[model samples]
Target chain A: MTAIPVQPIVSMRRVEKIYRQGDSVVHAVDQVDIDIFPGEFTVLSGPSGSGKTTILNLTGALDNVTRGDIHVEGRKLQDMSRTETSRFRRDRVGFVFQAYNLIPVLTAFENAELILSIQGVPRTERSARVRDLFHAVGLDGLEHRRPSAMSGGQQQRVAIVRAIVTNPAIVLADEPTANVDSRTAATILDIMERLNREMGNTFLFSSHDPQVIARAHRVISMQDGRVVGDERRDGNS
Target chain B: MLILMAFRNLWRNTRRTAITLFSIGFGLMLSLIFTGIGDSGYGRLIEGASRMGMGHVALIPRGYLDTPSIDKRFDVPSDLIGRIQVMSRVTAVRERITGQAMVATANDSAGAAFMAIDPGTETPETLYFMDFLESGALFDPKNRIGIVIGRNMADRLRVDIGGKVVYTLTDVQGEIISGLARVSGIFRTGVLQVDNYFVLLPIDTLRDLIGYTSREVTHLAVFLEDHAASRSIRSRIQACVDEIPGAEAVTWRDAMPDIAGLIAMDQSSNYLFQLIIFLLISAGILNTILMSVLERKREFGILLAVGISPLRLFSLIMLEAGWLCIFGLIAGLLLTAPVYGYLHSTGIDLTAMFTEKPDVGGVLFDPTIHADLRPISLAVILTVAAALILLSGIYPAWKASRVMPVEAIQSA
Candidate 1:
C-alpha cells in the first residue's frame, strides 16, 4: 500500500488571463490552480468556451501568464524573457494541433529535421533520430512524402514525430484528431499512446471526446473556466 | 542548405517570385545604364580637356592667376624650364606666351586673344582645334609671324593656309606694334570658343612681337605620367615653387573650377540615383517576402510547434529573400552584359535628349555617347541590391514570427 508519487511537471498558482475585445473584458482563463504530473496521460476535457486551449497555452509557455506563478519543470514561466520562453519551448515542450500543421514545403523527414536543426543537433545524430522516429511512427519508408502526399493519419503521425523528435518533457496535443476519420484518429491516438508509454513522456491532451478521455489515466474536466471534475484511474486498465 | 531551401520555396510560387525578381532586375539595369553613361561622358570630357593645354597641372606667375594681364607676366628665370623638366613625374612641360591682340586677316579683323607655343609641344591639344590642318603641317618653329586660324575665323576672315594676315596689338608700353603673319595651318577642333577666340603662333616670335625677353612667360603647362597623381604632384611642385620668386603651381582643377564642380555634381547625382534604385528594389523584395509569409502562415506555425525558434524562422525567411535577390542579381547581370556591350559599342545619341550639345566639364562633346562597362560596377550593384533585399525581409520575417501556432493551425 505504497502511495504513487505525484511529481508535478507543470504547476500553475492562481493564474488569470483576460482578453480585451472592444469595450468589455473577456476572461479567457480565470484565477486557477493546477499541477500536471510527469509520465501521466492527462486529459483536459471541456466545451468550446471552457478555456481549455488557454490553459494549454499557459502550460506550454507559448503565452505569458497574466497574474500568477507558473513553473514548468521547476523553471519560472513569468520570469523568462521572450527569447528564454522560446528556448524553454524548444527544449522542453512539443505541440500537436488539430490541423496537423506540417510545413507544406518540407517532406516528412525534413519536417522532423527542422526542430533538431535549429537545436544544432549534429547531422549524424539527427539522421539516426529521424530514422528511429519514422520507424516508431510506422512511417519508415514515407519520410520523403510531403504533407499533401500523405493521408490524414500519416500526416498526424508525422506531426507527432516532429513534436517528440527534440526529446521534450511533455507533448501538448490540442484536439489532435479533430480533422481525421475515426479509424485514422484511433491510429493517431495509438501511436501517441505508445510514444508516451515507451518514452515515459508526459502527455497533456485537450479534448472533449469521450474516446480520448477514456484513454487517459487522469482526467480533469472543466466548465466555465473552472475544473468541475478531477479523476484518476488505477493501473488495472 | 538555407539557400537551397529558400530557392526551392521561391520556385513554389514562381509568378510572384518572378515579379519580385523583375523589379530588382529592372532597377539594376536602370542604375547600370545611368551610371555607365554618366561615368563615360564625364570621363571622356575630362580626358579631352586634359589633353588640351592644361596638362593636369599648370604654373603661373604668383599674382597672375588672380589677374592674368600683360602687366602680371613675370620674368621666369631661364632655369625654370630645365627645373620643371627634371621634376619627378613630369612627362612634358610646354611654355606658352599668352596675350590680348587685335588682328586683321585678309577679309576680317577682330580683337582676340593669342597663345604663342612651340608647335611640337602643342600636338597633344592642337589636334582638337578646329583650325588644325589635316593636309598641311603646322608652322615651323623658325616661322616667327605665322598663325593658324579657326575654320569659323577663317570663314569670317576668308583666309586659308599660306595666306598673309596682319595683326596689330599694343606692347606692354601701350605703343601699337603692327606685324604681318602667314597662315601655316588651318584647323577645326569642333569647339567654338577655342576655334574662334584664340590663335597660335611660335613662342619665340610672340615674345619678340610683344617685346618680351626669353625669361618672360605667361604660364608653363606640366604633363604627368599619371593624371590621378596631379594633386600630390601639384603639392610637391608647389613646395618647389615656394623656393622660387614670383611663381605658383596650380592643378588643372584649380584652373577650371566650373568644370570640376560639374564633375562633382554629376557624381552626387549618380549616388542619389543608386540610392533610389536600392530603395525601389528593396520595396519590391519586401512585398514579395511579405506575401510569401502571409501565404505560408500555417507552415511557419508548424515549424514553431515542432520547436523551431522564432529567430531561426526569421533567418530562414531572410535566407529565402537573399536567395531570391541573388537569383535576380545573376539574371540581371546575365541580361545586362549584352545590353551594356551593345550600348558600349554603338553608343547612345544624346541628340534626342538635348536641344543643342551638352557641355560637360568645359568640354563640348558631340551627341554620340559612350558607356563604361566594368565588372566592378556590376559587382557593386549586385551586392547593394542583395543587401537591400536581405534588410527588407526583417519586417516580414518578424510578422511571420508573430503568428501563433494554434491560430495558424486552426485557421488553416
Candidate 2:
C-alpha cells in the first residue's frame, strides 16, 4: 500500500491574474498551479516580471486571484470577506518583505509581538513567546533595538522572527535576500532553514539569487508569467 | 501601538513636522492677539461711551433717552435709588440733569450740552472730570454756581480755568433762563465731541437755575462692577422700574446705539478676518498631512499586509492629527502668553496709525490698544482650531485606509 501524503498547507489551482494598463490587458500571472507543503523550504526563482512575487502574494492572500482558487491552510482566500481576509492573513500567513520593513517606532521584540498582540494574546504570554523566539533566532541582545539602529542582516533576522512567531501555514518572503550581502544572505537562509527543521514551519520564497535558491529543498521556476520548471531535491543540494 | 506609531512617524521627518507646527502656532498666535486686541478695544470704546454719561444701566423719564431736554424731568424716587444701590452688582447710582445749553464767555459763545452732577456720586474710576482734569480744581460743594468744562470748549469760548461764563437753556415750564458760573476746572478728553461740546455743572446749581425741586432730575444713571454684565443687570434694574412709575431703564447699548453699532460692525469684520486666516492655515495643514500620508504609502502597505485593519490605519492617522493639534496649541500658547501679557499691560501705541483722530460715530478711542482675551474666547478658539485640524486629516486618513497592499508595495 502507498504511504499516505500529508496535506499541503497552501494549494493554488491554475490561477490567473490579469491587469489593465488603460488600453490593454496584461497577463501578469497566468496558468500557475502550486502547492506549498508543510515543513517545505521552497524558492520560486525567476527574472524580473516573471510572476514569482505574484505567486507569493497570491499564496499570502496579499493579492486576489483572478480566475482560479487559492486555498491557504484550507481556507478559500477569494471567497473571504474583507474582514475575514484580513483575519485570515493575521491568523494564518506571515510575510517578510525584501526591504526588511520593520516598523521604525517598534523595537525588535515589539515588532515580533505585533501580530500576537493583534490576535489578542495576553501581554505576558506575548512577551514570553517573542523573547523565546528572539533567543532562538540568534537575536538575543537586540530585542530592544529599533529597525533604524540595527544592521541590514540583523534587521532581516528580526523580520524572520516577525514572520514565524505564529507558526503560520507559510511565511512568504519576496526576495528576502536581495538587499543583503552574500554572507548575511547565507546567515538568513541558515536561520530560515533552521526554523523549518525545528518548528515544522513552512516557507515560500521568491528570489532570483542562485545562492538563495540553492538552499531550498524545492525550486519552482517561472518565466513570462508561466511556470517552466519544477525541481525537487534533497536538503542543501 | 497606533498612537505610538503615529507620534513617532511625526518625528521621523522632524524638520517637516517642526515647520508645519510653526505654521499652526504662528497662525493661532496671530488670531489670539487679533481677537484680544478687538475685545479690549471694544471694551474700551464701550466704557468710554458709558463714561460720556450713558452709565452702564440708566433710569430716565419714559421718553428721555429717545428725545431729551431739561423739561423732561422726574422726581428722584429715593426708594428706587436705594433699592438699586444695594443690588448685588450695583457699584453706584448717580443722579444727573442733561440738557442742551449755550455757554458764553466774556469774549465768545458756543452751543454745549451740559450734564449736572453731584460730585462723588458716580463711578469715580470712569469720571472724565475727575480723571482727566487738565487744570484747576473740581467744584467746591459750598459754591452753588461752580462748573467744569472741556479744554476745547474753554479754547472755543476763549476762557481760562477760572473764567466766568453764562449758561442759557429752556427749563420745564418752557421759559428761557440763564445763570452765571465760574469755571472751576477744565478737562482734556482727547475726544473731539466730548472736549468740544460737554460741560459739567453742580446738581443743585443747575436745579435751582432750571426751576426744579431738589428731588427732580432729568436722568438716573446706574453703574456696575462689570460693563459686560449690562444685559443681565439691565433686566434686574428694569424689573425694579416696572415696580415703580414714570421711568424706564436703558442699557448703554440702548442709550448710545451709535457706539454699540460701531462695536458690532468692528467685531464682525474681525471675525471675518479670523475666518479667512483659519481657512488658509487649514489648507496648509491639510496639504502637509496629505503629503505625509502619500509619502508613506508603502509603509502603510506593510502595515496593512501585516493585518492591521483599515479602521485601525484610519485611527492612526487621526491620532496623528490630534497630536498635531495638541502640539500646535501648546506652541501657540507659548508664543501668545508673553505677547498678550505685554499688549494687555504696557499696550501698543497706535498714534501714528491714526491719520485722523480715532473717533467712530462721535466716540473717541484711545490711541493705545489693549488686549482683553476672555477665557471662554480662548477655549472657543482652541476648540475650533482643533476641530478644523482634525477635519483636515479625515480625507488623508481615508486615503491611507484604502491603500492596496500589492499595488502600494509594488509602487515602492
Candidate 3:
C-alpha cells in the first residue's frame, strides 16, 4: 500500500511580487515555487535586497500578491477578501517583527496575550496560556515589565511568546534577532529552536545571519530575488 | 481593554490634552451662558409686551389684528372667560375695549390710542403700566368718565388730575360719538411711543359711549403666569376660541410683531456667535485627533500587521474622541455650575455695560440681568457639543484605519 502524501502547511507556485519606483521596475520576488511542511524549522537566508521577507509577508497575508498563488494552511491567500485575510492572519499565522514592536502602553503580559484577547479568548485561559509560554521561554518573572523596561533579549523572548501563544499553524519571523548583540541574538535563537524542537512549533525565519541559518532544520538560500539552493541538514522532516 | 487603551492614549501629552479639554469645556460653558442670557432677556421682553395690555394671549375678533375697529367686535361669554382662567398657565383674564380716538382739551387736541380696562379686574400686577403712574390713580372707581393719560399726552392736551377733556370716535354704527372725561392719572413710561399716545379709561364708560353690551368688547386679554407659556396656551385655546363665532386666539407674538421680531433677530445673532465658537472648538478637536493619529502611524501599522481589524482601529480612535468629550463635559459642568448659580441668584448688575437699561420696541428691561438655565437648553447644548466632537473625529479615524501596514512598518 502507498503511504498517503504529506500536505504542505504552506504552498506557493510561480509567485511574483514586483515594485515600481519612479521610472524603474523591480522584480522584488521573481517567479518561484516553494513548499513548507508542518513542524519544519525553515529559514530563507538572503542578502538585504533579496525577497525573503516578501515571501513571508505574502504567506501571512500581510501584503497582497501581485501575481501568483499562495496557500497557507490550504486556504488561497489571493482568494481572501480584506476582512477574510485579516481573520486568516488572526487565526492561522503569527509574526515577529524585527523591531520588537510591543505596544509601549501595555505591559509584557498584556502584549503577549493581545492576540488571544482579540480572538475572544477568555481571560483565565489567556492568562494561563501566556504564563505557560512565558515560563517555557525562561521569562518567568518579567511578565509585568513593559518593553522599555526590559533588556533586548527579554523583550524578544516576550515577542516569541507573543508569536506562538495562540499555537498558530505557522510563525513568520523576519530578521527577528537583527537588533540585539550577538550573545542576545544567540539566546533568542536558542529559545526559538527549543520551542520548535520540543513543542513542534513550525517556524519560517528570514535572516542573513549565519548563526540563525545554521540552527534551522532547512535553509533556502536566495540571491537576487531567486532561490539558489535548498538544503536539509536534519532528519526532522 | 480597548476603552482603557484609548483613554490612556489621551494623556501621552498631558498639557496638550488639558488645553484641548479646556477649549471644549470653555466653549460649552460659554454656549450655556449665552443661552441663559438669551432666555432671560427674551423672557423679560415678552413679559413686558404681554403686560402692556396685549396679554400673553388674547381672544380677538377675526381680522381685528389687521383692521381693528369697534364695528368688527365680537362678544365672549362669561363662562368662556371662567374656562380660560382655569387653564394651566392662565393667571388672570380681563376684558378690554381698545380703539383709536382724538382727545382734546380747551387748549389743544391730540390723536390717542385708547385702552378701556375694568377697574374691578385690572390691577397693578395685571397692568404693568398702572405701576408707573407719575401722578394720580389708575382711573376712578366711582366716576364714570375718569381716564388716565400719559405725561406727554397730558402735556400736549394741557390736561392734569381732574382736568376736563373730551374724546371723540366712530362707534359700531359708523356714527361719530363724543364723551367728556376727566384726566385722573398721568404716567411716564420713558418710552416715547407709549408716553406720547396712550389713553386709559374704564371699560363700562367706553361701552356706554359705544352703545354696546358688556360682552361686546373688542378683545378678551388672557394674562399668563409666564409670558413664554403663550406658545402652548394659544394653540390649546384655539379650539375653544373656534367655538365662539368670529373669535380667534392670538399670541402676544402675533399681536406685537415689532417686539417679537426684534427678539427673534437678537436670538439669531446670539446663535450665530455661538456657532462660530463651536466651529473653532471643532477645529481644535480635529487638530488634537489628527496629531495623535499621525504620531502613532507606526504603532497602528504594527497593530494591523498583527490581526486587529481596520474597523476596530477606527473604533479605537472614535473611543478616544468620546473619552475627550465625556471628560470635557465633566469639566464644563463643574466650571459652569457656580457661575450659573451666581447669575441665577445674585445676578450681575449690567449697569456698567450700558448707559441706561436696554429697551426693545418700547419695552423697558432690567439693567441687572439674570440667567435662566432651562433644562431643555442645557440638554440641547450638551447634545450638540457631543455631536460636533464625534463628527470631528471621523477624518482622523479614517486616516488611521487606512494605513498600509507594509508601507508604514517599512518606513519606520
The number of the candidate with the highest TM-score is: 3
Q: For residues B45-160, what per-residue lDDT tens digits would candidate 2 score against the true structure?
A: 77777776768988888888777877787787668889998998888888888889999987899899988888655444546457778998778777787889989999989898
**By DockQ: ranked, best first:** 3, 2, 1
lDDT by residue for model 1 over B138-239, one digit each (tens)? 788777767877666777787888888888777778788877898887766656765676677788887777788876778877877755568987887787
Model 1 misplaced regions, further than 4 Å: A1-6, A235-237, B1-4, B62-65, B70-94, B122-127, B130-132, B141-146, B166-180, B207-217, B222-252, B261-282, B349-362, B373-388, B401-412
For model 3 the TM-score comes to: 0.92
Residues A1-237, candidate 3: write the lDDT tens digits: 999998999999988999999999898888878899999899999898899999888888888878889988788989888889778877878889888988888889999998899999999999999999999889889988978999888888888898899888999999998998999999999988998988888999999988999898899988778888889987533
The alpha-carbon deviation from the true structure for residue B187 of candidate 1, after best TM-score superposition, in angstroms, is 0.5
Worst 10 residues of 2 chain B by lDDT: B120-129
Candidate 3 segments whose C-alpha is farther than 4 A from its true place:
A138-144, A197-199, B104-109, B123-125, B134-146, B154-165, B179-186, B224-229, B346-357
TM agreement with the true structure for every prediction: 0.86, 0.86, 0.92
Provide the clash count, candidate 2.
0
Query: For every candidate, what share of the true interface contacts is present?
Result: 0.45, 0.64, 0.57
**What is the C-alpha local distance difference test score of candidate 3?**
0.88
Candidate lDDT scores, in order, read 0.78, 0.86, 0.88
- Residue B157 of model 3, lDDT score: 83
**Residue A1 lDDT (model 3):** 100
